[model samples]
Structure formats: C-alpha cells, structure tokens
Target chain A: MVDVKSVANPLFLREEELRQAIEMLFFAYRDFTGGPDEMLAEIGLGRAHHRVIYFVGRNPGITVSELLKILRITKQSLSRVLSHLVEEEFIIQTPGERDRRQRLLTLTQKGVELERRLTADQRERIADAFRKAGADAVQGFKLVLHGIIDAPDRERFDVSGGPTHAPVARVGNKIAGDKMPGTKIAGIKR
Target chain B: MVDVKSVANPLFLREEELRQAIEMLFFAYRDFTGGPDEMLAEIGLGRAHHRVIYFVGRNPGITVSELLKILRITKQSLSRVLSHLVEEEFIIQTPGERDRRQRLLTLTQKGVELERRLTADQRERIADAFRKAGADAVQGFKLVLHGIIDAPDRERFDVSGGPTHAPVARVGNKIAGDKMPGTKIAGIKR
Candidate 1:
C-alpha cells in the first residue's frame, strides 16, 4: 500500500500549499478543456452539450437520470443539451428493455464522429502528459486526483478505475486506442 | 532526472490512460469548483466574476490587457462580468501611473471579503487533498498539471511557478503569508 502517513500530517496543511493546488487546478483544467471547448463552440454547442455527447458515447445505453447525476445538473439543464443533440440527430434515445418509461441514450454515427473530432486533440495532450510524467509519477498523480474527489464519486472510481499497476504509458496508449482505445472507463453504472 | 523519458515513449501510450486522465480532471475540477460556484450563483455572480475577483485580488495592480491574457476571454465578455463587479462596488479600476491609458484592476474591501468567502471552502478542500497526497505526490501532481498547460501558459507558469522541492504543507502555510506570500508561483509577469 502507498505510505500516506505523511500526507495526513497537519503540519503540511499550510495555506500556501493549498493555494498552489487551487491555481494548478485552474490552469490545468482550462488547458485540458480548451481544445474541446473551442471545437464545440465552433459547432454552436457549448461544454454542456459536449458533456452529454461524451457520456452518452462512452456508455451507449445510459439512461437520462444517470447522465444527469454524472453531470450534476438538474433535469431541466440536461434537457436543453440532450434535446439539442436529439434534434440534431447526433444522438438517439430509446426505451429501456426492462422499463419502457426509461430513456436510454446512445450516440448516432454522427455523434461518434463528433466525439472523435472533439477528443482527438485531447487524446494527444493526455498521451504526452502521461509520457512525460512516467509510470510512478502517473500513479502518484492519479492518487492525488482521486483523493480530491468527493466520497461518492470516488466509490464509482473504485468500481470503474482503470487497470491497476500498468505502466503509465500503457494507459495513454490504451486511451488513444485505435477506436479511441478503451480508456478502461466503466463509466457510471446505472 | 525524473526519467520522464518513459513518458515520452510512444509504445506505452494507452487510450485507457488518457481517458482516465480526462475523467480525473472532470471529476476533480467539478468538485473543486462546486462550492464556490454555488456561492457565486447565490449572489447573482457567475464563475467568470469569481475569476476576475480572484486574480485581481491576487495581483492587485494587474492591468486589463494582462487580465485578458490570463482569462483568455474576449474583452467584450470580460467587460460584461467586470462591469457588474465594478458597478456593485466589488472592484475599482484606476489609470496606471506609468501608462495613463492602462486601467489597473484591484478588489475593493468588499471584493476582498467576497473573494475570501468564495475561497474559504476551496482552501479547506485543497488543504485536505494536499494532506492526503503528501509532499512527493503533490510534486508529481503539479508536474502533470504543468505538463497539461499550453506552451505559452506553461512559460507563464515558469515565471509564476510555486516553490521548488518544498514540502506540500509548507505551500499552504506560505500561501497564507501575511500578504499572499509569494510561493514561487509561476504567475505571468507583465
């Protein structure tokens, strides 16, 4: 197991360290989403729509409620983005096998196309980052990121976390899978 | 020295790894910003406003053009959010002494209070994460985050980068410096 005793010590909880973490998140996230956001903006869809398309593409049969939870947006907010994708024929909604009232969402060929277009640049960036950080650093990177997550979402991480103990480069190559490779993301289980 | 050569090796790139990185960012950022976003929402302010308030508070003598580069948003968009903050007396703009045309932005007393209120929870969350990750993990985490930034911003990071090799806990204490103590932040220098 990772030795986390030092991490739990309060002496390290200085205010400056926390602020650095905050700025790191801000700058890193802005760049991480920048490529996708620019592309989405050009197509007249914002990040919200991108999120719907992404999750739906990842989990071909995800229900509307499940998507909402992952997004942490209300049904009303989700509806606007979902409706746009549906109207544009980028996504398809079908009734669940077990419950006709449940709407299962999936990407259309068009949705898949768009998702690829959006993710291509992001994939390259992520791959390079993994390569630069190396296996050990990558593991440490994931641990810190995972730790920052709230408990519930983290539980989902336990269920869906990618392959364990693999070299960091493998994760990147896997993420860039020929078919966007399997990010080993189980996504959210309904 | 970190053996980042492994990170650059193409053979190790896995699609799964990239996807995991994406999700980690998505989840971590959502949670990190959630508390402040809600508080901002309650006051009829959005994250855009919080950002302006934050940077201005951090760099009290920052100019408009400088702010624009940092935010990476158009002047028009910034104007809308900034006007709201200024009109409400949260921020004040003054002509630069060296360049009369340059408008320097700084937070008012009210703005400082708002910035603190908005950041309190975030500070706590970041401190906890640092404590959980320890000094070494925190360093790896920053490396990955720094790698993700675009070249220009990354260069800016070098200028504003935080401490080199100090314990993570020290960063927090240093950030709480009597006057926003300089933590070796790679902030953009104007």
Candidate 2:
C-alpha cells in the first residue's frame, strides 16, 4: 500500500492540477445526477424535489428548520416545492413528539417508493465505481470528499467510519440542542 | 503509493457504503458550489450562469450548440441565460470563422474577472484538500471520480494524465469530428 503520509506531491497544488480537479468535479457531478434528473423530469419534479425526498427518507421525522439547515436554502425557496410534495401525498408532516409546534417531515409509502427508484440507479453507479477502484481508493475518495466539506458541517457527517454510525442522529442532536433542547427530532426510528 | 491493485475490500460495495458515498457527494457538491452560488446570487444570477461563464472561460470561442451539448440543457433553457449574459456584455457571441452559421462564445474582460473571482475560493479549497490528501489519495480520488462518470463521456475527459494534456481540446476534436469535420471549434488561441 502506498503510504499516504509519505507521498506528498506538491505538484498537485499547481494551477493546472487545480483546474483539472474543478472540471472533474463538474463532469462527475453532472453525470452522477444525470439519471435522477431524467427520472425527476418525467414527473415535473426538479432536483429540489429529489433532494427533499432523499433527505427526508434518510432522516425520518426531521424538522423543517433542521432540513432548511441541511439544504442551506431559504425557507421561502423550500416552501413551494415542499407544499407540492405534501399535496401530492409523497410526504407527510407530523408535529414533533416533544414540540408540537415543530413539524417533522417523513416520506409516505409513495415517497419511499419514489426515493428508492430515484436512488437505485445512483446507488448502483456508485457501487460499481467503488468496486472497481478498490478499498484504498474508496478511502481516498471519502477523505477528499470529506475535506471538501466545510469544517463545521464535517462533524455532522461521518465520512471516516463504518455504516453503524448515524450521521443524521448527530445532526438531530445538534439542531435539537440549538432549537428544541432535550427534544428528539431526528430520533424517530425507521 | 498504495498499490491500488492489492487492496480490494468487498465491503465497500455494501448498501450502507453506497448510501454514504451518495451523501458525501451531495454534501461535498453543495459546499463546493456554495461560495460561487452566493456570489452569483448577488449578481442576479444562479448556478446556470456560473456554469456558462466557467465553460466559456475554459474553452474560449466554444460554439453555442457545443456548449448546449456540454450543459445538457435545451435551447429554450439556455436562451434566457445566454441573452442576459450577452446583453450584460459578460459574454460575447461571434459567428464561427469557418462556419458563419455557428456562434462562438467567449467571455469579456468582465466575465473573465468574475470567473476568476468565483473559482478562486473553490480552487483554493480543492488545492488544500489535494495537498492534504497526498499523491496516492489524489490519484485514487481522480480514479474514483473518473469512474463515476458515464462511459460514453469518459473518453472526452482525460483524467489520468498530467498538466500538459487538455481535456477541452479533446472535447473540441470529438465534437468537430461528428459535426464540423476538418473544422476547429476549440482551436481558438486564447
């Protein structure tokens, strides 16, 4: 195995290398989302809708403010897309157990199905890549991606460990501490 | 360097691992674009505008149809953004030297400055991560990202090499081959 600590290529910081990195990200992300984009377009739902479904499916019973924080979009921007999803019966909102005023969002059965279908192609694509790249590459991929995230949000995501750790639970605890202390917003069991 | 061939962990293909990869991409892309998105918002633009500026800046004198193909957006979708950019003088469109019917897009001084400022933060972020990740990890990162791209478009990108190779040039050659044979759309000297 190549010692990650021993092989530090200063050339990687060159402008050309940096620009290459930029373009790679541009193309990779474009292709990564391509399948879901086509699928969502058929239903007249854009990326915003897909994101809402994906996050809510990931973190069942997540509150509106917590989601807004996760998405980093304004409440006004999320309102219309959210209303549409709820009206379409793809998502259902329930008041938080501790804080009745806090609406916790979860996917309906239909939402779960749509989320599964939308994510299936993506999951397979990622799996194929990881499988081909091997364990070391996967580790490198995760480290680089985690580094790309802002530090404050990095802790909220566990990019370093196994699957048993729950990132959403941490996000819930953080959000709950700030907004609804002692309340279990992200603690809703799947 | 990690002998990428030696360490093949099968567990990386598990569903949870796949999901983590998905979330990492989601969060990473979001943060990667965050700085530019804010700057674009201030100028009454969005990610679409930033993308147009970026690609046009990268491949000066790139053709309209060629750009549309790269963006995977329709004529109708690009029309408004293109018009606004042209009207605002951030970008200029001139007829191709060989094919007068084809409009070649290039950024103005203002556009170049904007693109520079917009990408500075992102470039720095990437460079920092790459420097920290070391050569092996960077190699692995590139391989995984390249693998994430679809097969058809994969050849169009040269992710395996050093700074001397130009990916946009390859894209130009490919596009020129299919449509404008023996004509150079991407050969404009910057």
Candidate 3:
C-alpha cells in the first residue's frame, strides 16, 4: 500500500514557491487587463463595462438570465453595468419573442467595434504566451486550468461549451490526441 | 517578413475560444480559493486576513512598509486587517533593530497553525493540477503566467524568488528537468 500521509503534507509546498505563484497571479492578471483597460478608460468605461459588452457581442440575442448564469453575478450587479452599456448605445435589449419577461441582448455596431478592440488585445497576449510556451506546454496549461475549475462550473463549462458550440468531438479529439496544430491553435488569420 | 495587418485582425480569435478562456479564469479562481475560503469562513476570517498572515509568516520579522509593498494596499486598508490579526494574537510586532519607525512582524503560534491549514489546501490544489497536467504543461502554465505579468512586477517576481530562496538555478532545473515528484496536478485524495 502507498503511504498517503507523506503525500498530503502542506510542507510539500515550499514557502517561496507559493509566494512566487501568488505574485505571478497578481502580475499576470494586471497585465492581462491592461490593454483593454486603457481602451475602456479613453471612453470613461471600466472593466465591468467591457465584460458586459464582450459577452453580449459573443452571444448575440442571449437572454439576461443566461448572461447572469455565465457571469455568475447577481441580477442587481449585472443590471448596473447593463444599464450603463445600454445608455451608451453599446448594447440593445429587446423583449424575448417567447418570453416577454426575459430580455434578449446584443451588441450594437459600435459595441461590436469596441468588443473587437478589447478582445483583440487579450487574444494577442494569449497567442504570444502560447507561441513562447510551445504546443505541448499549451495543452498541459489548458488541462490544468480545466481541472482547477469548480466541479459544478466544470459541468456547466462542458455543457454550455461557450459561444461557438463547436462539437465536443472536435475539442475532445484535439485534446486527447494532442493533434492541435500550432498554426490552428494560434487562431485563424484575420 | 510577417504580415502585421493579418496579425492585427480581431477575427483571429473566435468568439467561442475567448468565451472559454473567460469562463476558465472565473471558474479556476473560484475553485482555487474555495478550500481556503471555507477554512477561513469557519474561523470568522476571510481571504484578506489569510493573506496578511501568510506574508508575515513567510517573511518573519518583515517591516510594515515591506508588507505594504507586497500587498499593494493603502496603509489604512492594511491597518484594518493587521489590527485584527494583532488583537487576536495571531501575529506579533516588534520595533525594528535598525529603524525605530519600522515595525517588524512575525506570526504567532496560532497564526502559524492557521497559516498551515490555509496553505495546505491551496498547495494540494496546485500540486494536483500540476500532476494531472504533467511537468510539461506545468512549465507552460508558469511560463505563460510569467509572460502575462507586467515588466516591473515580473522583475520583482524574479528578484524575490519566493519564500524558499531556493537558488534560481535549482528552481529552474527542477521545473525544466521534471524533477518534481509525488505531486498531483489536481484532484483531492478524499
């Protein structure tokens, strides 16, 4: 039988190592938001605004309830941000055809332009890191992140599969077989 | 020469991929803190308190000023958390040997015990993810995180090198050569 006590000790995580990870989280998150933050700042917007715009842009005609689920924020919190975006003409809300109580949201043309600018910066950063880390490492990185997700959220992630709804077959085959081409993963050319 | 315009196009990142990444960040961070958050909640403490204790424990006899630098919060903000920790006897403060104005801080026994409990949960989470992802993915994940950090903080990360003070050579070698052993990348034993 394997000895489990030795395996579970907290000391296993060296102090310096954990601290390094903490600092990395701080710096990386800051830099990740920096580009889009600047663009938003120019128009007196903030991170919250960017999130609402980005989600609406990604899921055109998505309901407010669905967005709240994806964002995991209370309706009240989301309402403040959504109100601002709508007032700014960055998003449009219409009564749901099937359920009037539900509001369907989509980005306006202006919203689309802004969303493109914000996400483009983020994509470039991820792309640069992917290229630098190489193909194998990218797979491991993504897998680790997937594993770190909460169990319930993981279920949601698997089910919803986000905006594209690319067949799970494609994602699974690519991940399991490690057949994700470097160029393809780098994303399609503009 | 590469085509710069092609790289600049916003369509390079599909809406699906971006949403997936955004979801991953939200879910991963929530799970990453879940274990510790539970422990803290039971003790009537929160993440902010845990952070103060962890840093003080890591750098025994560190000054308030240094702690502020690591935390990146205002004196008033740190004061609230620090006062509570001190009042509860989780931490002890002493006048600096060199500077009368400096207050050097260290964790008390209670603080150490609590710190251990919180960190154990976090370390196990990270270790599991590392093991599951394997050494290659772990390297990629760390590299990408490092790349995401802003330049100055990145320098701070390089300079501090975590609490272990493990020589950069040793740390780099361990990560690069697949020497980390008996660690899981994710999944709790229970």
Candidate 4:
C-alpha cells in the first residue's frame, strides 16, 4: 500500500521520455528502412515489395498465408505485389511438398542476389550497432524491443529453425555468445 | 592483424542474429504503430496524415521544411496530406513572428484531441516497456535505436527543451535519472 498522490516522486513515466521514445522509433525505423526503400524505388517497387522479397528469401518454403500473416496485409494487396515480383522473376512459387494445393514461396538466384544487395547496408548497420553496444546492451536492446511487440505477434516473431532450403548465406559467427569484435569481424573482407 | 579466412572461425556477421534483429524491428514497429494506424484509418486517413499531425503536434509550430525534413517525403506528397489535415481543421498554420514569410504549423484543439487519442497507446506502450526494462535498459534501448538512425537525422532526434508551448503534459519523474520503480509514479493512474 503506497500513497497515491505523493507530491515529489522519483519513479514515473516522464511524458517527455515517452514522447522521446516515440520520436526515436520514428527516426530509427525511417533510417533503418531508408536504404532498402531507395534501392526498391530504383526498380519501381516499394516497401511492400521489399517485405515480400525479404520474408520469401528468409523462409524458403513459406506459404502465402504465412506471409500474409507475417506481413498483416490483404491477400489482394499481396496479389498485386506478388504479380510484379513473379513477373520480374524475383520470386518463384512451387507446389508445396506437404500440400498439393499450397504454393510455397522461394526467391530465385536473382532474387537472392537482389535481397542480399538490398539488405547489405542494413546488415552492416546492425552489425556496427551491435558491435558498438556490446553483447549485454544488444541483449537489453532485444529484450526491450521484444517487450514492445504485441503478445499475439510475439510467437510469429520468435520464428526459429533454419529455412527448409539449403543455406543462403555462409553461417557467420555466433555474435551473441562471442565477443562482438566490433569492426574487425574475421572473414573475407567486404 | 587478423586472419582473413581462418576456416572454422568465430567472427563474422551472424546471419541468424541479424535476421532476428530485423524481424524484431519489423514486428515491434508494426505493433507499435498498429493502434494509431487503426485510429487514423477510421477517419479515412493513413500513416502519412498521422505523421503530419504527430510532428506538428509534437513540435508545435514546426516549419513545413522541418516537417518535410523529418518525414523525408516529397513536397507534393506532403501537400496532399497537409491539405487534408488543414481542410479538416485538425491543423492551422500561422505566419512566423520574425520572418512572417514562414508558415508555422500547430495542432488545433480537434487536432490535439485526435493526436492524444492516436498516441495514447504508443505512450502507454513505451511507458510499459520503460517500466519493464528499467531505466538502464531504456538507455541501452535508446542508444541502439539512436545508433540505428542515419547520421544526418541524429541531431533532430536529440532535440531538447520542452515543446515550445505551455505545458502540453504534466511533467512526471525523469526516467533516465531515476531508478524507475517499475510502476510507481506521481500523477496519472492506470
């Protein structure tokens, strides 16, 4: 039992603080997606297309429903975006092994190339931030971000296990377990 | 001083980690804005109009150029959105005191009501996260998010001092400086 209207308090949600957080998400997400948005713009696509390419690339055999669930967009909206990607030969749909009626989505080599190129800057940016923040801060960052997500979508977000297809990227270091060596990540130099 | 291709190594861009971070951002931001999006959609407005109202509401006399810079959208695009907001009487523009040539954007009473309703969830979400993560983790959260923003926009992200108007909100405890007692705060109850 604590006092309700304590005059001078230490624990509170500073309106300014919350407002700053809102602005932070806005500016951060804006810049984070800025790179891909520009690249997609060159090809006459938008963030909608990027979302399709990214998810398809990540989950090799993901179904259209799964994608729609993940993206939270209308089937009709996806249909318009998908037609362009398919016509552009960026993504290919194959009959699902488990379900004959299902269409499994995967990116073509060109699609993979484009996806990698589009996300390269993003990857670089995250890697840099993770390095700068250190592993503990990264963990904290993830915790706070995870906490921000809605509970229903949290399950979809923790999506794990590798893609059903062969490896798209050479497995990199265990960033979480290891000391994030900041800039000098041992590898074929960029 | 580091080996390039040391086979079976422990340093590289952990694709899984980066992918998880990307997904976290996608889910977190999606859910974060979902509430406001729905609110705006009811009035036949979208994220664009929401952005206009938000920045103007937050800055309280922010110039159109400043708004344009923050949004990074085209003049024509903003014009369409601004027209709707202005026509609807959600926002009003005034001649600048000094220049008189500049138009200063502010939210009308209707605008303030809508803005508050639209952002109430967002404020609560952030407050809840800050409470859960505590102050230090909030710092980490801000740092990582700040790191995510492009260098150019970083300055704007750090805009300090109160909104250039009378108390828009009753100031609560300083989140950063305080120990963050999880849920205890002066003023405003759940």
Candidate 5:
C-alpha cells in the first residue's frame, strides 16, 4: 500500500519543477500548433484563419455572435480572419433568416477541404498520442484538457455526431482498433 | 465477447467531432494562459516577457544562447524581451566566467517575486485540475502532452525539470495532493 504520510509537503516542492511545467506548456503548445501553422502559412493564413474555418465547418450556419462567444475574441479580431476566409472562398456568410443583422456562416467546399486538411493532421497527431498512451491515459488526457477549459466553454467540447456522443457498444478489433491497441472493444461510456 | 464487426469504422467518424477537438484545444489553451496573462498585463509584460523571466529564474546561470534554444525563438525576438528584463533590473546579466562573450542570467529578488506571482496562478490552476482528474488522469495527460512536443524538443523538455522533479513526497493540499472540493488539479507532468 502506498503510504500517504510519506508524501512530501506540497509547499516543499522546488520552484524549478513548477517552472518546468510552464516551459513544457510553451514548447508543447508551439509544437502542437506547428504542423497546421506551416500549412496555414503556405496559404497566407494563420492560426486565426484555421479557427474560423474549423468552427464554421463544425457548426454549419452558425451565427457570428455564436462564434464570438465560442472564440471569446473581439469582433474586430474575428473580422480580420473572417474577411480573409470569405475572400478566399473558404466560408460563406448569409443573412440570418430571423435577424438580418446576424450573419450565418458555413464552409464552402474549398473551406471544407482546407478544414479537413488542417484537422486531419491534428487528428492524426492526437490519435497517435492516444494510441501510444492507451485507453485509460487517453481518457485522462481528455478529462484534464476539459478541466483546462472554462466551465461554460466545456459544453462545446462535445462533438456533434462523434463516438463521444454515441452509445457504448463492445466491438472487436479492426483498423481503428489496430491504431489504438489495448482499448476495450466496448465503447467508452464517458 | 465483443463483436469486431460491430466496431465503428474510424473512417466513418464525423468531421464535426474532429473539429470540436480543434476548438477544444484552442479554447483550453487560451484559458490555461489566461491566469498568467492577467498578472503579466498588470506589469506591462506579455507572455514573451514572462517566458524570459521564467527561464532565467529556472536556470540562474543559463546563457543567452541556451535561452534562445530553449525558447526556440530567434535571438532578435528574444533580445527585445531580454533587454526589457535587464533594464528593469528584474534580471542581472553577468559576464561568463570562462567565455567573455557569453552572459549569464540571474533573477533579482524583484524578479523572483514577480515570477512567483505569475507561476503561482498557473500552478494553482494545474494543481486544481490534477485534483479534479486524479492520479491516473494526470499521468495520461502528461503522456499526451509529451507526445505533442517535437521529438528533439522532448530532450530539451527534460532539461527544464518537469513535475517528475517536484518533491513528490510532499503532502500538502497546495501542490499535488490537494484534496479540496471543486479545485481543478489538471496534472501536466513535464
């Protein structure tokens, strides 16, 4: 049994250790964003552009106000990226049916393709990491990531029609299973 | 026994779900940085500035070249922040004992106090998340984060002395063992 009393006092932990966590965050975040960033730069885009395309692709016909809420950026900040996406024909904004002042956003085919390209790279990375960590660790990673988000924003983490939303069913190994070895065939209930 | 045929096809996963993960990363990273950003803002320091102080505080005798490599930013970009830190007297640059061209960095007491404030906020958030997720989740989260870093940078990550270097035996609720209710301790082991 692990002796709880043997645990060192939390306050006694070295500042250097805590500082390392901060550096890891910086380096890891940079590397995490690096792949898509290179792709975005090629097309004269930035991370901001990727965000606009990604969100619109996820929620078709989402209004600007709703996007602002999710992004938590000023409308002015959103405008710069949104304009580029619109000009590039990656996103289409239409007048809202009820509120003409509201603009509804959707991804054009080109936008969808771009979003797919950007997201596929990210998914591959995440999936690979998930596979390496195994099922239990993947669950923990998601929980910790979810905890990092603000309470209100956490609700948006649900994928509209993904496995996360599906009912758990025990299944057998296939290609997906191969990628994530050791995961129980049963669907994760979350 | 779980039926292999019943398993969901990886190809069949909806694009929306992948997109949600992308957004989650953005929102969560923003939220994670928010705590330190607020404190830094009050002192006319941005994230870049905080990075300089953070590293200097972590490695008292680290050189400029070492810092640039650790930060992965160009020396020109680093110079701007380094100058500010030096001018403010938060960091002292001493001539290298062996190499006259190299300057060693150390944090002044004022710098240490400021650094503590910035990191304390972040540490509290990380500690809170860890408490919320528990030990297994914390380990998983770190594994995933480590995977996100570039392979080369992973070695550099080691030099930073992450959570592994934390006085794991410490028992107070302040660091990792905090059993407090509603406090989110999301462990990201560097």
Candidate 6:
C-alpha cells in the first residue's frame, strides 16, 4: 500500500510516520469511547453527557465555568447538556458557598452509579491495553498524550500531586477522600 | 486529590495509574482534534463529516461497505452524512466495476482540498507531540495505541509494508503511487 520509492526520502518518511500517528490516534480514541458510547446510547445520552458525568464525578464541586474551560464547548451547548442531566436527576447544582451566584455541579446517586458503570467499561479497555503493552509502553503512552494536550491543560495531569487551583468546596457533607473506588482526580498523583 | 495511604497499596497504585491514563486520553483527544474541529465548524461541518472526507481521501474508490466497516456507523447515520457531502459536490460516488450494485466513493477536487487542510491541522499536532516525546516515546505510543484498538482493526496499522486486503479500484487517472504528499494508506509502512 506504500510507495517504496518515497520511503527512501527522509522527509517523506517523517511525514508517513506522522500520518500513521494521526490515524492510530483516531482509531484508538474511537475504540476507547466505543463501550461508553453504546451504554450512553441505551440511556438516550451521548458522549457529551458521559463527559459531564465523568468530570462531575471526578470533581464533586466543579463549577460550570470550570467545566466550560475543560470541555471547550460553547455556553449554550453545555447548558443544553447540563439541563438534560439535571432534569433527569443525574446531576444536581448548588450555589457555591463563597459566591452565591456561582453554581457548582455534583453527581447524584444515580449519576454516580452511571458514571461508575461507564468508567468501568473504559477502565477495562485501558487496563487490557496497558497489560499488553507493558510498563514501558504505558509510560510512553502517557508522556506522548501529555505532550499532545494543550500546555495549560497539561498542568492538570502533572505528577506532583499538588492542587493546581483553589479547592472547590466539597458538597453534601461528603467526608474527605470519600471518592469512588479506583478513581483518581485530575493532577492528583499517587 | 489522591489519598497518600492508598498509594502504598500496589492494587490501588495500579488503579490510579489506569485512571490517569484514561483522563490523559480524554484530554489528549480533545486537544488533538481541537484545530480540525474549529476549521470544520467554520464551514458548517462536524467531525463526522471530516471523518468521511478523510477516509475517502485516503482510500479513493473505497466502497460504501468498506467505509461503513471502517467508521462503524449505522447505515442510516452514514446515509445522512454521505448525502450532505454528495450534494455539496465534495464527494462523488460511482458504481463498482466488479459489482455494479456496490457504490465506490471518492473525493472530488474540493473534497481532496478540504481533506488535506483538515489533515494538515491534525498533522501539525501529532508532529509536535512526536518531536517533543522523542523517537522512543513515539514508538511506545504507537505500541500502546495498537494494543487498544480492536483485534480486527489492528491489521490496519501492521507497519509491515504489505497490503492486508485486496486492492480496490483506483478512480480517475490517478496513477499508481501518485498520491498526495505526506499522506499514507492504512497499514502501509516503509
């Protein structure tokens, strides 16, 4: 399928390598999300909903603005998705203690269960890949992916285990460190 | 934030590692597609349209069934997107030579141009990541991603410089080995 003559050119080889990388990323992401997509479809939710559930479950008191920055979607788009989740009781919004006008989002019990199930499907996929690729490959995967992320957001995955921003208030009197089993908050290193 | 006590447990550490991999993938994919998505949005197209344009550009004269298999989208959904591209003259479809009933899809000149533009955006992202992550990390990245893909699709990125399937008919006067620069067909390697 490749033109053998072109392979002799160093520049062309680099281009080919990059092209393969692009396709590999596409296929990897597609299959990575496939399991969750099917589950979301069954519930009449889509990828957007899963993202909200995933992030809110990760950050119990994440504000709408914070989510907007993470998702990079327009305010109107997030509003539609957020309203659907709220109307279905998968998520609840509370006014922030520090700023009464700001709404912080948290997952309801239903939301938590759904997020767990969805994430479990994804976790299985990644675990299998990690197991097959071995530790070295897994490390490379993370490093390359970190490089691909925008610089500002790359701070979210730093291994320092330090808080990158002011701590959002934990809602519902949840005890500290009472997160779901097998979960890690963004940028929270072990 | 992670619980320091939990980090001492090997099982918990593995879980944490997997969770971090999952989050990194989500953010990486979001930022990776960011540029192409913006360009497509400006032209009233979404990622779905871009995928169709991309695969078609890569495999000219690719049959609809082949495309359906690659994209894994429902026939109805593909029909909607395909119709839009056909109407816009971005893509053209012709009956297969061996099987007249089968529709073989190829890009029009406009589609080719658009595919190149969108791919260039993605190419820039991957090239930067590869350069930053270095050759060893890039190899590791591909290995891990290859593991993540489904077993059947893994054949698409074999990197053996061999064709995995029968060749589809080449449309137009596009000479054999005459392809867009910096592009590669699936599974082709140096």
Index of the highest-TM-score prediction? 6
The parts of candidate 6 lying over 4 Å away from their true place are: A1-3, A159-185, B1-3, B159-185
User: Of the candidates shown, which would achieve the greatest lDDT relative to the real structure?
Assistant: 6
lDDT of 4 by residue, B45-143 (tens): 999898899888877877787778778889899999998999999999999887798788889999999999988989988888777776666766777
lDDT of 2 at A23: 76
Better of 4 and 6 by DockQ: 6
Residue-wise C-alpha lDDT for candidate 6, range B1-190, written one tens digit per residue? 4455443565776666777888899899898888998999999999999999988887888878778888998989999999999999999999977779978889999999999899998888888887887666676788889888988677667433221143322223222352323334464533
Model 3, native contacts kept: 0.49
Tens-place lDDT per residue, model 6, A54-153, is 8888878888878888788898999999999999999999998878987889999999999999999988988898788766667677778988998877
In terms of docking quality, model 3 is: acceptable
Local accuracy by lDDT, each model:
0.73, 0.75, 0.65, 0.73, 0.69, 0.78
Q: Give the DockQ (C-alpha) for candidate 5.
A: 0.33
Clashes of 2: 2
lDDT for model 3: 0.65
**Two-chain DockQ for each candidate model:** 0.32, 0.30, 0.30, 0.30, 0.33, 0.38
TM-score of chain A of each: 0.77, 0.79, 0.73, 0.75, 0.74, 0.81
- Candidate 4: TM-score, chain B only: 0.75
Q: What TM-score against the true fold does each predicted structure earn?
A: 0.78, 0.78, 0.71, 0.77, 0.78, 0.80
In angstroms, the error of model 4 at A111 is 1.2
- Chain B TM-scores per candidate, in order, are 0.77, 0.79, 0.74, 0.75, 0.75, 0.81
Candidate 4, TM-score vs. the true structure?
A: 0.77
| Tens digits of per-residue lDDT for model 3, B59-159 | 78877876786677799999999999999999999987767887889899999999988888877777777667665555566666766665545444342
Clashing pairs in 6: none
**What lDDT score is found at residue B168 in candidate 6?**
29
Alpha-carbon shift of residue B159 in model 3 (angstroms): 12
- Candidate 2, residues A90-145: lDDT per residue as tens digits? 99999888789988899999999999999998998987888788777787787788
Q: Looking at model 2, give its docking quality level.
A: acceptable
